[model samples]
Target chain A: MATTSRVARPRLSSTGDALRPDSNGSTRERLTALAFIAPALLGFAVFYFWPTLRGVYFSFTEYDVFNAPVFVGLDNYRALFADATFGNAMLVTVEYVAINIISQTVLALLIAVLLHRVTRSVFVRSIVVMPYLVANVVVALLFYWMLDAQIGITNQFLGWLGIEPVAFFGDQNLAIPTIALVNTWRHVGYTALLLFAGMVMIPHDVYEAGRVDGASEWKMFWRITLPLLRPVLALVLVITVVGSFQAFDTVAVTTAGGPGDASRVIQYYIFDLAFQRLQFGYASAVSVVLFVILAAVALVQLKLMRAGESDVA
Target chain B: MATTAAAPLDTEALLDRSAGGGGRPRRGPGRILAWVALVLIMAATLFPFLWMIRTAFSNGAALSTQPASLLPVEPTLGAFRRVLGLASTEEAQAQGGSGAAIDFGRYLLNSVLVSVLITAGQVFFGALAAYAFARLRWPGRDTVFFLFLTALMVPPIFTQLPNFLLMRDLGLLNTYAAIVLPFFFMTPFAIFFLRQFFLGIPHEVEEAARLDGAGPLRRFFGVILPMASGPITTLAILQYVQAWSEYFWPLLVASEENVRVLTVGLGIFRAQTPQGTPDWSGMMAGTLLAALPVLLLFAVFSRKIVNSIGFSGVK
Candidate 1:
């Protein structure tokens, strides 16, 4: 599509072999194309495409590895309604997503605007994104060390301020939020750079026009920059929200849904159900719900935010 | 975050000197405030890493007492030595290590093997599929591409369960193939990323090759691949970092000590140590080693990675 729009001509050769624009050549082209995509197609089928169908099918059955999946239509979904831990997982995941998205988006917006208006230093931006480049497990462990209740650097600093040491991961109330914050610290810079990319695409003349009208930086940012930046912000939100919903790695490494299941996001819960409890069918049901939620979120946000059609020309 | 562009900003003036828009003077309080925020962000961003270095160098026994200090307390190579299995059991215990004979050097090699294999396979197969999607006129082309893309929305857990079952049933568990198989194929993102790049290659480049009686394969190899090398390298870097940082799938499929990649090894290492202030120096040292390869890659390709952040989500 990208090529055809630009070239404005018939294809150089529909037959892959330009020397022979004949029936055999077209057949050869088809075979070549198939060969090109054969590995990906096989992988897609075995790994992705089939699993999606199997997951949905498993939701309707009662299966552990010992027995064949008994056809118990809707049993897993009905079970989920009464499952408090499943409900907690859903709640915890939502809380995590909300915290992560809000904090990350707000901080990233501030950083993006700062970079756009005051500095475009590659050095500064690189520093900001360093945490993101590290593995999630590595980041989680680093923070787990830094925020340990007794000897953590954070608590050590709090002591200097005469503040009570907080149990970042030990307290049930604090575990999820702490996990969210740790991830936010890792992510904020990358998010900021993403928003900055969007900000770069907005024409300078719009800001120039605002300055000509004697608009303060505050007013210009609010009235001009933010409005023109809707599409980009929407994209970032969609990406971040979707990404946060799959918060397994950090939780697995750090809290392990701990401080009394306070941080068991849905993904970890699914792992627990499928692996630890051997309830593969029930886990599949939860996964289906997660799949639906992600699909709905992506679609709804894109629709509401008008991601394709930007406010700016 | 512009984490990798160490080469670009070695000095203090992070502000791009070419920043001429907005008409704000360079010396105002607003500018000063911006610089302060930049400094604070940079400091906050780099602190954990710097602290990782500090903690990695500290004597694990002295870590808790001087946790707030900027420098290591009774600095030693004990942690690094223990994690790498260089320290004897008694020496490891003496330095507050868990005294587990875990070989991090082996895990590092394991990580190298897994990440390199996956990167090579994912990039190569993805490029092939991308070429088909971008350049071919086969029937159902766009539809097939769209089918591949919707896989992205399928949360990994959905596939992860069945894939694990498949791996186990095949009796491939604890082997690299089990872990590598799931990721060795092209990601939807990888395919999409390469396809987008391929589509932008001017047709004439391939047209000349084709007019020389070159077949599709020859055109792809001779013209398209070289022209799209930049995106290919970027995608490879992105994918390598991704494979190196992978924890979830590798954790599930390859749980054996020898097969375990760095992320999983680090997780288990963190788990093995006893609770209260348990040998953080050793763990941080291990963490730093696990993260080193990707960091080195980032240092070399900082701008490339930084430039590609806008399109990133897979990592």
Candidate 2:
């Protein structure tokens, strides 16, 4: 079964003999392939490729919404370096990404472990996954309402315990963390589902062997499951980090980067510059910076995972 | 590939092991504690939606009471009626102040139309491209596929400024085309996902179709597509949900009421409400209405959705 399945796998990256120049069907097959692929390629070029190239070009020029772009080499980057708000946004974004990664990963892993040990029914699992299906705007609005200082149920619950109603979106020091907590609440279920899938992929004999050796569940998980789950853990980390960096929808709905830019992450900052301030060139420069950071992180993650695979092999 | 093969077996083994009663007994204090913790987690996760429902069903006066009611106090469909434009003008004025009436029905229709079109377009084009990449041996296939994969790393925000500028240049702003065109045809993620599904299909089936003198299109439509219904359905649902819930791009391109989607419409409603004295019940009603479709989609196809997520992550 394994060998036949392996043989059946489509080789997407190779040229089969049927398509070689000497083959009788090569020309017809090539024409068919191009016809099949034309629509997607056209859309990709128009939407993705052209925009990306223009974005890079705009990063180097000075342009606003009204006028033509004037070429200025590296001036935008220099101004970005000297800008205080940009620096603050960078710091806040890094902080947000770090806190989000830690909290979401830990909570998701915990839930996945618990679920693996306890539940087997899809119904129970779906209840937990429900929050992830809600729109970001909806989640943000729901939490905004639930955390309202005067009439929110969260504060009401707190008041019953003799605590004052905290303004979740008002205070600068608490706003970013509050948003992070809400973001975590929105995403933890999906993350847990990913990790749960990874956990269930492990072979059963390993657990049987550990049990036969009188290892407790805790020991078995730490000694056996953790090592095997490293690749998936890396995957989860990469995805969450990339997502948190680009987060804008929730912030837009809940805070609009406001109460004096306390929760202004990079994406929101870029939107403010491009749309609100009309500094298209500067926004593109900031976008370039964000792209570099994300690309670097993704490359490092892929390399690390590849190295781990080689070690196992 | 190895893990994929092992996963189904692991599930079966897990079921058999638990049912055969070898490792640990089911009744214990620890087990009870685990169940308690699970239930608590479930409650915490679901509490916000419950609050939305509570607020959605109540009227302004009931919500404005000193302590908010956990249950609907004056249960009325007044907010829904107002949102859907089913209420009379006098009825709307009697409910609340300036923020009572919005063209929410138009927004709902716009959202539905844009989302369905984008989903159908994306799934169709994505499957065509994925089929070519998965089955046909063509020059530059790998390079083109790799290029598509690279788009995954380029943040959507990076392209937003240029795409918006392009829309403005073409005089497409405030039109549904502006909101729908950029994403209507194909996305890198969808193509990649469909390609993976296509690769998993056995080559023998396509060979059989070819032997029967079916053309490439016929083989794809008749042979491959029937086998791909699971992944295609998953992709369609996902794309629909995503297009429906999108906020940022729509907020940029389609700020006009005629083309406004639910998420942006809800945001506009929130902004129009007076700060520190928000129309909480109205905003909650808008949110509940916006969230209802995707939530219903989940209620029906949650297992397939979850499985697709797992497949994407693991694969």
**What is the C-alpha lDDT profile of model 2 across B1-315, one tens digit per residue?**
001111111233334444433343256686788789889989999888889998888775557674557887588888787777677877754665243458788998999999998999899998899888877766888789877766777888888789999999999999989999989766876776677677767777788888899888888899999998877888898788878878889999999988888998888888876455676777788889888888999889887777655635322
The DockQ assigned to candidate 2 is 0.45
Clashing pairs in 2: none
Judged by whole-model lDDT over C-alpha atoms, candidate 1 comes out at: 0.79
Query: Where in model 1 is the C-alpha error above 4 Å?
Result: A1-25, A307-310, B1-25, B312-315
Write one digit per residue (lDDT tens) for candidate 1, span A1-313: 1121111121322333343444233666678889999999999999998878888898888889667889899989999999999999999999999999999999999899888888776767777788877899999999999998888899999999999999898899889999999999989998898777666656666777777788878897898778877766776677789889989988998888897889999999999999889899999999999989988998897675663343444
Q: Provide C-alpha RMSD values for all models, in order.
A: 5.0, 3.9
lDDT of 1 by residue, B1-315 (tens): 101100111111222332465454346787888889888888888889988989999989888777788998799999999999999999988888988888889999999999899999998998899888777667677678767767777788888888888898899999999979988886876776676667656677777877799988887788888887877788888788878888989899998988988899998998896475577999999999987888888888887777666533323
Q: Rate the local accuracy (lDDT) of all candidates.
A: 0.79, 0.78
Give candidate 2's error at residue B129 in angstroms: 0.3
**Model 2 chain B: ten consecutive residues of lowest lDDT:** B1-10
C-alpha positional error of residue B180 in candidate 2 after TM-score superposition, expressed in Å: 1.2
